[model samples]
Target: MTRMSKSESRHPVRKFFLFALIAGAVVAVRNAVSDKGGSYDPNEANER
Candidate 1:
């Protein structure tokens, strides 16, 4: 049998945070898109 190295250890907490961040970003984008109907305009700002 081979011994495991320190770098080979898995961290569940780290994985959870990474997944949460990606999921949050996706949800935020989805909400933003849905709020403005189905079209997305890069140059159309609320200030202009």
Candidate 2:
């Protein structure tokens, strides 16, 4: 068997974190875009 460099061994781990970050951003954007206007209102709070 052959030995691998430190950078080479960490490459896959770096790639996985990058992919996870991108996926999280995509899900957040989709959730915001698909919202159906159920937002909160400061003025409405006074009525309660």
Candidate 3:
């Protein structure tokens, strides 16, 4: 059998964090779109 190289090793923790970041962004956008204003306005947030 062939041995796996160091670079070929799986990084579960790294992959998990990456997935979480993407998922969080998706959820944030979804929530923003479904909110009362129906959109996200960075300027309005900054003005608060």
Candidate 4:
């Protein structure tokens, strides 16, 4: 028979979801930064 511990068995799913979330955030940020015609002008807010 095989043996499994509670902590060891629970780690993979949690790790996979965490990795997936981080990967998704990275892709989203890359897409946003790569877009054109979008600019952030802090002075406009200050003028108001």
lDDT for model 1 comes to 0.66
Tens-place lDDT digits, model 3, residues 1-48 = 234444335656776888899999999987777564554665665565
Clashes of each: 0, 0, 0, 0
Give each prediction's root-mean-square deviation over alpha carbons.
7.8, 7.2, 7.0, 7.3
lDDT of 4 by residue, 1-48 (tens): 134566656678877888899999987875575453234444544554
> Candidate 3 overall Cα lDDT vs. reference?
0.68
Score candidate 4 by lDDT: 0.65
Candidate order by decreasing TM-score = 1, 2, 3, 4
- Candidate 4 wrongly placed segments (more than 4 Å): 1-9, 37-48
Q: Which sequence of candidate numbers ranks them by lDDT, best first?
A: 3, 1, 2, 4
Q: What TM-score does candidate 2 reach?
A: 0.53
lDDT of each residue in 1-48, candidate 2, tens digit only: 135666757678887899899999988876665453333443444554
Which ranges of candidate 3 are over 4 A from the true structure? 1-8, 36-48
